[model samples]
Target: MPPRPPQKPNRRMRGFEPASGLLRDRIRTVGEARGFAVSRLLTHWAEVVGEDLAARTRPVKVGYGKGGFGATLTLLTMGASAPMVQMELPKIREKVNACYGYNAISKVLITQTAPMGFAEGQAGFGPAPKAPPKQTDPAIRQRAEETAQVVQDGGLRAALELLAQNVLSRSANRAVTKKG
Candidate 1:
């Protein structure tokens, strides 16, 4: 019998695919099932709407007409923020349309929940309390100051030094955590 050539596989194996790349199709399927045709609206809510609005409100779902035209975006907000969200409906619709690169959202509806919340937890609108300042390591503090010495302005130098110290401290923490 003549030797048979090795059969080629139908699909080639890929190495190290990104989580997002692999999950894209599944995410789309799930999102579409949940009435989110354009998942970016949900993923990039903060970008579509301003930070202030984003923090106070959360996109629940998008309702499309039978023909899939003139989508109505439903948002969940705390009872207190409902009035503010109501006033910004026009603005929100415009911004959402802008994100979709068309007049996709014709209406924006706000659903209010209790402060403590029920199914969906309350999205905090109040500013978080500031954390007490931590004492910086003296060596890190000195190194950051030395690095910022090139800056001419004293105020700018001080700010830069503080920023450097914060960055180094975070990186140091990560290293220590990884080692431990």
Candidate 2:
């Protein structure tokens, strides 16, 4: 046989795989078999259930009968909120089914747990405290007020001065924080 030229790698084949894309097939296989659209349900839990309910509960899994389709959704909730969630089962089921575009869920089973519910992996942390509003230099504030005095509207003049003051103050705080 004659020698052949070296073939270049296909550029189309080279691409980044998203973290989620790698697990998608596995999630679909396990989730669908159990009658749960796990990825969709988890991603849109807040939309499927109201914000209030979603905050208090987490979807655990779905169990289907031998016939299939009409599966029971298992939800994990804090003991205190379980009763409230129990009352809203019908509403939750309807919303979930709507997301699935069919009557995919027939029942919602509430499982109560300790106030600290199931941990997906790492422990959850509370939101950080907001930084306090920065204080502007008196000279800068005076200059901003004097410059904004050109605007005839009282509200506009005050707003302009305040905006300038805020921008300067925030920049000053950023510089100080970066130094420290």
Best by TM-score: 1
Query: What ranges in model 1 sit over 4 Å off?
Result: 1-15, 120-127, 130-180
Write one digit per residue (lDDT tens) for candidate 1, span 1-180.
999999986976688778887788988887788788788887788998989899889888888999888989889888788898899999999998888889988888888876567645465556668999999999999999999999999999999999999999999999999999
- TM of each candidate vs. truth: 0.58, 0.53
lDDT of 1: 0.86
Per-candidate Cα RMSD to the true structure, in Å, reads: 15.9, 14.7
TM-score of candidate 2 versus the correct structure, residues matched by position: 0.53
Best by lDDT: 1
Clashes of 1: 0
- Give per-residue CA lDDT, model 2, range 1-180, as digits (tens): 999999996757458878787788888886677556657897678787877787878787888878976788888876677788888989999988888788988988987776544565221323447999766799879978888989999999999999988877778789999999
